[model samples]
Target: MTTVESKTTSAEATKLTVPSRPGFRIGRLSLVRRPFKVLVNLVLLAALLMLVCINIGRGDFPLSIGHVIDVLLGGGTRIERFIVMDLRLPRSPTGVLVGMALGMSGAVTQSISRNSLASPDILGITAGASAAAVALIVLGGGSAFAGVLATLGLPLAALIGGIATAAIIYALAWKRGVQGFRLILVGIAVNAMLTASIGWLLISADINDVSRAQLWLNGSLNGADWGSVWPVMSAVLIVGGLTVVSSFTLGALRLGDDNARSLGVRLQLRQAALLLAAVALAAIATAAAGPVGFVALAAPQIALRLVRTPGPPIIASAILGGLLVVGSDLIARTILPVELPVGIVTSALGGPFLLYLLVRSNRKASA
Candidate 1:
């Protein structure tokens, strides 16, 4: 064969031997597209929408799904609009944004730690936020000045507390570098300390303040309003976008530290940045919804199993997180004789799941 013909044949052989990833490229931008992942996300999104409608229609008035959709699209009467828009709309969206944040946060943490059990809640991020918020509530109770501070300062306090706690955990975990096992161990210890602090604050506070703090601690969507939804939405959009962009490195990180280093991954810097993103997401979600439990721990793992990814896919995890929160909230509202906190329902679900994971892990180890 001529030189050009041989070269062409070699190129074709290379192409045949190297399997392209299942995705599309558009000039400068490319995405790894998994059809199953897309379908799962779409299904989750649809389920989330349906739940939102059902949630909006719930209550004494009881509007139908069709009516809810009509009112949502600016077709209903003023009263219907008032009920859907003014009264009930905020809670569902708030739940969704919170769920998405937790979901992504969980995915990042779990991926970084390479532990199925690693999550913001387990790592004390949620506990730190809760501690700060509860302290604000209890310390600032009874006075007009305190009430104002509690109203305005709670979210900020929670965010700061979570970030600080994460920093401490990371610092403690860092010997030569942050190992996944060390990080998780440090997180659990910190979580215990923070939980103890929260308990102490509650005990020392006034009765009424304790009652209020307890309500908040239960993680209810009882008073979620437009005001609360905006911050979480903003966090989910901005920080979440950053997390998703950074996720390209997660697969590398998951392949063990030595392997990741061999692949030119800056182990310390990348891990810290990703962990910071996870902390921010978890903090914001906790601030909005009072540390809604188990969604963070469960969502990413559920998504991981469903999509059959080596690690949790961020988008799918976020969607599943939203679905879990919305569905749990629906059950909280309707399934019982009285309204229960969303966190309670989630804990009930997550506790069993955690045990199952532990059992499964043990079995695998033994085998």
Candidate 2:
């Protein structure tokens, strides 16, 4: 297998090295600030902010960006306040958080696997969450949002399901240690079985339950509010911080398991932690938004390309992911008479991108 050398192509990252402090070797923020990186981040952020503004007015009655900001600042008429703060505010954050979570998780997944196509969606983590949520909604006679999942919410169920499924896949793939290729293969099998289960549940479900179940499966943010934003924001802050801190390890891991271990990296514990972290990120996004597709598959790769880095650029991926989701949601809301689920928009974009990656990867391998 050809390995991606842990060499950074960005001259700026190469030059701005901070000396290690005494006592214990502490990691820095590991932020990349190349001119291209800066430009890309700025453009993406601007685009994200633009989309957020646009989506705030995405209902039957649209408001200007000025009006949306006015409502956000606590001075608006009844309808304006209701539209921006109550109805649209949570949706923006939900889409952003979902994208960030999936993007960072996808970066970690691909970095560890050394496979460009390795993402939570392809590796069955999201499928696992989906299946569990569907089971709760359909079989256990429990609601996905209320009932058993009320306290921690469906996100908890999703987290458990995603982590458990990941564990099962890893266990099945373990032969002394987890190999990336083997892990991907096992994940594919698990994803297939779990997808079949979801299909079965959907098919046999009561008519009344079908619409509710499908809505979640489609990953819509129809009624997103502050209730959804807090939990997701908390996850993004805590888990996202950890991802940034640990990104150096992911870069090292991309140099190949043997090489990373040779450098005295704690391979087993680190791998487990990274996997769990990725699962948590994916699970949170899945639970909050119901398995919106493709952000995970595309964000890290897009970040790497933009940032000119050998490994997944965590912060860049997060920003890109947020932009992708928010922008997609904007399109989904305004592209037609009726709003489509953001997931459908992402799938429409990501599907072709994934196919292109596979074809390119195959061509390179053949070459």
Candidate 3:
């Protein structure tokens, strides 16, 4: 090559190597700052605090933010103590933990499947947990054992269901190798069957038991305590932390399975690991919060839109998911005369968002 041509090529290579800076960038408003992330983190923290306050501040004897803080710090009235410390505090943390798991798990599923529509609920994972839990509830089986089975057993069952579901979908989609669209299609079909089964189970129950099962099925944090929170939180944190570290490879996978494999990404091993992590996260979250939907789906999408980047964005999604779930839980508690189920609240918000994503994905695929 000529000297000028080689020089031009080198300059182009340099341009390609330049990393884009993250911040609020707009026409004549390119204010770059390191504290930008800190600021965003602060905003999320503030939102979480505000939601907690709102959650505690409502109900029969509402407490102010100051009072809530004081109670948390061990310096409030007996009434404030009971309301904030005894009642509201536990649910808030459960929301945060469940939300984080959902978000992180959703990001993993989307990344591994290479599809935006992929989520815990869409893949029959939540349905699996819900089915198992509902079966326990409807069978007139009430005990510490049943509760444990519902809370912890469901997640384990969900892990099995999720892994099995993924395996089946992957197997069905394996036209020599897995295809994202085919996997997604099979996942949706499986989800429909599982959901139908759950409906039938609920239908077969008596009126009172049907009501009880409905509450659990709808995904409420109404009576959630720290007892239920810790186990799920521990599982989610371990899985999420490990997955966050593997995010770089996840990003590379977005380039397509073949390209990633050609780059020596060990497509099978990485995918299996990711799918296991994703299922574990979803199961823990579901067990904690009764198949709380849409946080997994909505949180990752919200994080992606906020960060304006492609790939998993697992950490951001986890943070956003925590915020979304905690905030939604707060809303469910305080929005009306009667407390709403957290799952119902998420479905109300997330269902529309899922439809929008579906439409957008279809348009992109068509285009």
**What TM-score goes with each of the models?**
0.92, 0.87, 0.85
Q: Clash pairs of candidate 2?
A: none
Worst 10 residues of 2 by lDDT: 1-10
- Tens digits of per-residue lDDT for model 3, 248-331: 679878899888988889987888788778888887777677888888888888888876667657877888888888777777
User: What is residue 310's positional error in candidate 3, in angstroms?
Assistant: 1.2
Model 2, global lDDT: 0.85
Q: Write the per-residue lDDT of candidate 2 for residues 1-367, one digit (tens) a residue.
A: 1233334445446766653322333384334336666787788888877778888876778899888878888888998887787767888988888899999999999988899999999999999988877877775535544355445557788888899999999889899888888889999999999999899988988876777889989888886878788778888899888988897799889998889998878998999999999999999888888889999999999999888889788888988899889888888878756789988889999999999999999999999
Q: Which stretches of candidate 3 lie above 4 Å from their native place?
A: 1-39, 140-154, 206-208
- Worst 10 contiguous positions by lDDT, candidate 1: 141-150
* All candidates: CA RMSD (Å): 3.4, 7.1, 5.7
Each model's lDDT comes to: 0.90, 0.85, 0.78
Error of 2 at 23 (Å): 20
Model 1, residue 248: what's the lDDT?
70
